[model samples]
Target: MKVPAPNDDRKGGRVPRWLRILLPAVLIVVWLALAGVGGPYFGRVSEVSSNDQASYLPASADATQVANLQAKFSGSDAVPAIVVYERSSGLTKDDLAAITDDTKDIADLPGVHGDVSPPIASKDGKAAEVFVPFADDSDLDTNVAGLRDHLSTSTPDGVTSYVTGPAGFTADLVAAFGGIDGILLAVALAAVFLILVVVYRSPLLPILVLATSMFGLCVALLVVWWLAKWGAVQLNGQVQGILFILVIGAATDYSLLYVSRYREALRDEQSRWRATWIAIRGAFGPIVASAGTVIVGLLCLLFSDLNSNKALGPVASIGIVFAFLAAMTLLPSLLLAFGRAAFWPVRPKFGSEHPQVVGPHAKGLWARVAGWIRRAPRIIWVVCTIALLLGATGVLQLKADGVPQSDLILGHSDARDGQQVLADHFPGGSGSPALVVGPASELQPMADVLLNHDGVSSVAVVAKDSPSGTAPVTADGVQPVGAPGSPPPEPTTVDGDVMLQATLSDPADSDAAEATVRSLRTDLYKVDDGILVGGVTAVAIDSNDASIHDRNTIIPIVLVVILLILMLLLRAILAPVILVLSVVVSFAASLGVSAYVFDHVFGFPGADPAVPLYGFVFLVALGIDYNIFLMTRVREETQLHGTRQGILRGLAVTGGVITSAGLVLASTFAALGVIPILFLAQIAFIVAFGVLVDTLIVRSLLVPALSYDIGRAIWWPSKLWRTDAAILASDSDPERLVEEQIDAIGAGGRPSHHHEHLHQGDREHPAP
Candidate 1:
């Protein structure tokens, strides 16, 4: 092995020395500036985000139409907060008086809309409830906080008070999401950093890799924040958190591939400039294909009817784009600046021996695994496929219809507790009611219909002059609230339409309430097809329906898009089809396993419908990446070594880097659990587990062994398949065939024969 002179610049050719120095320096400075500008936007994401479930419903959804019509009848956009005051022994006179005073005090608050409802005592006499409406334009969380604080200090002795309803739930969701900027990012970055440190075992290299990820996130956030600010897209804590993780994980993964290539190039090329160029050229294709697949898969979300799902597409795609740019540009520049020092004690010296290429005798874990595959390719694939199928059977246990709103937050929740207390004392849907909008002429008929339903505890029609802003409606008609013989309050009418509010017999977030809403919509539409039903329960129903629709619609599109990309990438239809099928099976196994874990292991009540869709998008798109990484290298190796030997070499060489990359990505996604939101937590587990499955099993064994077993036909309809077959036929001896293939590809040196005896040993005990 010959070492080159330290000042060797022959490989740099006629390129100016100053120009090389200036290029990397400029890239570093530019990235630093962009990162500085975008860093602070992390803390400001909540400004443009809304957690209101109604806001995410598709515009064409029945709930959305009803929500739009609600403002016309009320003349104000307000979200209701239900305050429950409970005493196990029963509320005394003093407690009732105190509640009356609390309502008056709440009305004086800054964001209070119109009027606050006086405390209404339950028949059980154990609890009293007050409905407070907060103006939508005002700071809702702040107003809810003030109301809670006032009640906390002023509630009568021995009475428990809690603020829970749409507004309270919204406040809880906001608080849960508050960690996205600080804790979530810190946990994810810390996890990735620890993983990188262990993988590289170098101090400076981990820092460099993290710098690439951080800079990419900062720039991605800068662009996303502006897009959200301009109202071109919607942002939520969920989307924001995902963007941070995606950019960091993807940028780092891409960086790792580049680093591997750079180190390999450094061993062969003495000039640092030449090595950097070589590394970029080698890394550019797979990284772009990986990023493009993810971007297109994410973009497929645009077809989703749910706004949250739709918004995630472009927002996450933007993050991937920047991750690609940073990995391709900034990471390379930084690596160029550091050169051999980046790897520190383990730096690759020029002219050093490379890992033994494609042989049973190679001395590494992956090499050993490769040797095993060479011995029994068909058996390995058959057993792996059977095991994956067995694991996939657990998908039947998955309960992804949707979870109650109270279950959205994983831990303790004031809103959830209050909803229970409210349910025990009075109608379950006290504060949150199913809102119905219909023609004013059909008001009496609608009230009759509402009164006929078993699920409806009570019904009311909005009236401007009514003390509670809504008058109770009975089978007869709208009734007055003040005194007997008093005139009935006129129903508020907007463009000849009237809004009715029906309190359900069950909790607004309960599955029973959703069922009731569905039934009521069907029954109500029979009386008047123009009637629209919308509220908390309706919103949940619509969101779940859209998610299921998106899951069914987008999954196939993603498959087609990724399949085409793979075909173009591998230049072989059969190989891409096989790769896609392997990942699809892996995703199913992951979900099936996740379903069992979510049910029996963790005792999660149920999942949101979008959970599977999100899991598929990430697992399939990102999962396919490992296949791309493996198959592309196999294709490159095959051009020189024929199909059977190429699979072995590609697997051995890529095994370490791809596994490390998978760990990095899985760890980042797992960090989503820190947010205390059930949806993110579920997503975190599904993706994390799915990636490991893809890396360790599918990519490592199934795809490789299956392709190896098929031999050259995996590249059918391509010239390499025919060319490699001819080379294999020309010589019966494996060592001679390898030398002939090298000559066929126009290489300069005779192939290494140190492993010639190893090939002879394999030939003696040929693979079954």
Candidate 2:
């Protein structure tokens, strides 16, 4: 199949030599300035990013309510770090003495709150647990490190110590995300560069592509940082990491499309200026359509109930915007400056035969695929659909309800280790408790309900007059720790409200604790509708529930939105429906594969509910990108060639470039695995694998075959249906006739290019 010629009129007429040179120079300088200004914000993202779980909860969530009231109860926001000292042989007198000394030292550390609870020895006599409240404003990682250093230096010789709890976990999480700036970016860029070098087989071309992508990311970061700083959006490590990879991957993908068009154009036009303009016009529609689909789908996250998911929508959309801008402007300018040399050793010469020639028929790999489709379009789509349906059965195995907070981070976690020790000795939820806030007059009633649950180990109400700031509440009433008949201190009250803390029998992050918190809320809400139950367990429950809500709400919205976008872009209802179905099937298959791998191979406890939501948004939005690329070209080709011939021509022309773009995107997302976060790793694998599926099977085989079997009806309700322009354009050329015969034989002995009668409208004027 021969590529269509570039008309000077279609590209806004010929560009003058001086303007071409001057335009590229201005673009280069502007992009370099953007990169220079935004580069320094890389390592400093943490200044605006947060990892706090409660901070991401929905405003209406019980945990969010309790967290907001925490200052009223405690006078300051504090994160508790539980320090556990253990000995296999059981605790000795010296060990007990050393534990006391360690507590005092811990209290003296910077960022450590003044109220350090005395070390409480476990009944088993093998372990001691101490609660150290760290001010929320402190540098968590630094404080945790300092505490660890102090304990290691001052603890008894035979005893071991670990820093764990909300604070410890938060510190570990912060440290994990710390890799995003340096290691994650390095790996993603390195992978993209290497892939580009191999794909294009040119060093200079890869460098140029990398520069465009990096510039996009740098400028995107600059804009997003100020937005985050100004409170227009929330920034978190997960969102930040995703933004980086998305920009680089997306920018490169768009660049690949433009570069493919440029190289193809270079062969047809002698002047680089004309070639660049033609390439830009040809590449513009598909690139913009592709980016628009992704951006709209991501924006659907705004409907999500969870703050984290909501925040990600605009954050990622901003990245995609920059990616689109860079590809359309920066990449085109750079390519124009270098012209044919951009491809270097494999540069295309003007008027050279299309480089991928195979025999006199021009039957390349994609041509072969088209021929295979033509032979049995029905059977090809049927078999592929059946296989995909079978693979989708594994979705039943997907455990996306939630995973424990401790498991959120992949490798070793001192907090996780300490939780186990704490559970083996003291109440699992000692330092972190399920807090209940209600009217001050009803504090005892709430405390009694908590005490009634088997999961509740103890209950305490905040008492301002007590030395420990809290007094125990038993079944009878508030119990004084002082002499008998002495008056029990009044429970602390703020705005006629009081807080009650219930220590649990299970670890704060465990499922049992979450269940307990749920049950407590159910019981307490019956007593008083305004009562709030929250803390570590409540945060987990609320976060998981919100994620589930988001998955249900946002997934459907994203699909509907993308479906509409596809319909508008393709200008056909039936085609958009089919494309949406194909992508949905592809997404299900990807999730199914992930489910089996996570359950059997990785032995992951489960997945975050948001995982499927994120996977759906990315896969369907991104997976449909290849279809957009293919079908738009197919539609364009159909306008010139007949529908049947256009399907083949479009598939043949687009196959290599689309596949390269998919592989590039897949590799970039796969780079997310290097961060060692379970959420990122799952997303990395799902998106990477799904993109390849879209490229290799869905876009290449199923969509094409289905469209071919359906014929011009694929453009239903559009004027292109029932029209054939191939004869009017090339019927007089003898070489075209010979090529048609060759293509017919290549396509399963099908009859060569038979023109159809034009549709009812404009039979006198053939399609241009």
**Runs in model 2 lying further than 4 Å from the true structure:** 1-17, 355-360, 482-486, 724-768
Question: What is candidate 1's CA lDDT for residue 106?
Answer: 86
Model 1 lDDT tens row, 93-164: 999998897778889987888778889999999999888889875278788888888888899889999999
lDDT against the true structure, each candidate: 0.88, 0.85
User: Which 10 consecutive positions of candidate 2 have the poorest summed lDDT?
Assistant: 759-768
Q: Model 2 over residues 180-236: C-alpha lDDT tens digits? A: 998888998898888888889998999999999999999999999999989999998
TM-score of each: 0.94, 0.93
Model 1 TM-score? 0.94
What stretches of model 1 exceed 4 Å from their correct place? Answer: 1-11, 727-768
User: In candidate 1, what residue range of length 10 has the lowest lDDT sum?
Assistant: 759-768
Best by lDDT: 1
Per-residue error for 176 in candidate 1, Å, reads 0.9
